[model samples]
Target: MAFVRVAALSQLPEGGALGVEAAGRRIAVARVDGEVYAFADNCSHRDFPLSHGEVDAAARTITCEWHGAAFCLLTGEPTCAPAFRPIAIYPAKVEDGAVWVEIADEPAPAEKAGGLRSLGI
Candidate 1:
């Protein structure tokens, strides 16, 4: 796996997530309090794009708009219902004014462990 440039820092909202493809996998890059984070773009519950979700910089979580599931940005752990599984978080960094994500040809086996379930909240 290697770090690949995805988007320009200036293009990402200060408290938002951006969907991008890295190593053919959908990834969400988020910015919070001048820092950057990356995780699987697809929500664990409904497989919706988490990039379209809302980011809570204060809580360090991203909420899925489809089902209102929230996941920790740093750990990718589910923070609420409608989603019990954690997302796959990838290594990310900001350098040269660009957002870089360390993506692999295939998500790590651990990252492939998420399950989908629509437990109505």
Candidate 2:
């Protein structure tokens, strides 16, 4: 996977999360305590956009708004139910005042075998 520019670092406020499209993928980027994290934007429980959810800096998690599914900000592992499956996590960082995310050249992890499935998009 190669890192690609997604957004300006300034665009992500402290304790904030942003949804971006990069490398033909919908990624959710979050800023927690000055560190950046990225994951697939879709919720593992409802196929809803996780970007519409809330960011918990203290817990280092992002919660899905529809069914209260929460995922680890760094690992994309589901931390709460209605979402037992984990979403895909991407490496992210701030470089030269810009946010960069690495999208795997192969299919996203969430699409592979053992991947979680929500109701539908």
For every model shown, the clashing-pair count is 0, 0
Candidate 1, 1-121: lDDT as tens digits: 7999999999898998999987888889999999999998888887889999999989999999987989999998899988888888889999999999998877654366644333343
TM-score of each: 0.91, 0.92
Taking all chains together, the TM-score of candidate 2 against the true structure is: 0.92
Q: Model 1, clash count?
A: 0
Best by TM-score: 2
| Minimal lDDT window, size 10, model 1 | 112-121
lDDT of 1 at 108: 54
Superposition error at 31 for model 2 (Å)? 0.1
